[model samples]
Target: MSRPRCERCLRAQDHCLCPLIPHLQSRTRVVVLQHPSERLHALNTARLATLGLVNAELRVGEVFADLDQLLATPGYRPVLLFPGEQAQALVGYAQEGCELPFMLIVPDGTWRKARKLLYLNPLLGELPRVTLGQVLPSRYRLRKAPEAGALSTLEAVVQGLNVLEAPGCFDQLLRPFEALIEGQIRAMGRETFERNHGGR
Candidate 1:
């Protein structure tokens, strides 16, 4: 039988990561659009992000209803954090568009699933878009990246917040992410995880 899951963190009881997360607040709100399939995936990271950030929320759906409401919310500019040639560099936006804080709308799923979200919800396609820049290598050892620039949901949030919210946001957010990775590594054993994650 499967181990009992923690009601809060939603992981196995022993692997509960809720207590490790730091409470981070920012003027900018984070909205994660997660596909239903990824809601319970063992390695999903978006849920953990919402746990720590005061202004963050996770919405599970194939097509969203509040695309209009969220974008229209006063005092916040909703922008999609999907990378593309048309996606303005996030740093450029944070610097130039200093008039208002951002509401980062991120899609959490496989590349195909994320694309499906954009297709299903045409309103999302109309939002201003932003992309991360000069990122270090991804530390998501649990899954193979679909492409070179891809990042886990939590990592993307950290990167975006660090650029748009404040400095050190990356380090604060990274604590929980690194803790989760280390816990999984310990569970899998160093030798097996190293072999699987490209170490000798």
Candidate 2:
């Protein structure tokens, strides 16, 4: 029997959910700094962020070597997303009332690699860090992390936007993600059903 194709986008050639794309507008731009390794994975949620938000940008790199240049582009305020006792929280930027739009810099990788990226990039160290406080549970089942509250890229973006009271701006992006997961589950169930009933 031939391998079943992914049902979400119906791309036997590739897992492309391009048809289910959602376009959203936001006052806050999301900049996802995906680790080079995670870019190609079919399940990477950063891609969801890129597809969901009109203002979202996804840049894959091993480190933040060019982060300053990236941030210097027009209409972007880059903020590092990291949690630490010594780190100044996300609230600092809000209190300052900086007029520029904020860009949430999320490190997409294992905890260790994320830490390495933080340390290797001097520009990242200089930027104000924002740590989310809601502590929501993660929805990503395929990847495991030590922190139960650690969220996928899409979830983090949602939470961040909601915190800024711009939920409607990126709310559409959530639909495609839900559809993708649902499609995958339904496909698996169909395969199971067919296998069990095929000989009957």
Candidate 3:
């Protein structure tokens, strides 16, 4: 039989993270485009971010049909949170054309899958790209990051919002994410975690 789960957090009922999740409001609108395969993963931090932020929305799919309308949000400039040669650093990014808040579009998936999302949806590639100025070490100890600056979707969103709004404004969003990481560590046992992850 399947274990019972929390409807909101989707975690096993006994280990629900709902209590740690905080409801935060941000000036920047966050839209997370998640790959469908990751929708049910145990470490789906993108879902946690969506649940914690009032202005955030999560869409699971490869090719988004409604992306046109979604990006048409008024009074906010749309920018993709992705890294590339031309990606502008978001730290102190000057509002050249208009003084509008940013609508941050984040793609949630592995690097290959995220790239596929862009290939399937050409509009995503056309958007202005922004990268975090500082690449902090990830708190997700369960999985090794694919690259040096790679971060979990939740961490990326939190850092992005901090850049757009005030520094540390969205730090609360990490409460549940950190809780989840700790829970995973406990479940795997301290010895195994330390052996595999170097306890870093």
Q: Could you tell me the TM-score of candidate 2?
A: 0.75
lDDT per residue as tens, model 1, 44-144 = 68998888898989999998887788779898888999977789877734566677888889999988999999999998898888888777578887677
Query: In lDDT terms, how accurate is model 2?
Result: 0.68
Per-residue CA lDDT of candidate 3, range 14-132, in tens? 98999988988877889999999998899889999999999889999998998999999887889999999899988643433346888999999999999999999999999999999
Q: Give the candidate order by descending TM-score.
A: 3, 1, 2
What's model 1's lDDT at 154?
A: 90
Off by more than 4 A, model 3: 92-98
Comparing 1 and 2 on lDDT, the stronger one? 1
Q: Note the clash tally of each candidate.
A: 0, 0, 0
Q: Estimate each model's TM-score.
A: 0.91, 0.75, 0.95
In candidate 3, clashing pairs total: 0
Task: Please give the range of 10 consecutive residues that has the lowest summed lDDT in model 3.
Answer: 90-99
Report the Cα lDDT for candidate 1: 0.83
lDDT (0 to 1) per candidate: 0.83, 0.68, 0.89
lDDT of 2 by residue, 158-184 (tens): 777766643244556677677665566
Top lDDT: which candidate number?
A: 3
**Clashing residue pairs in candidate 3, if any?**
none
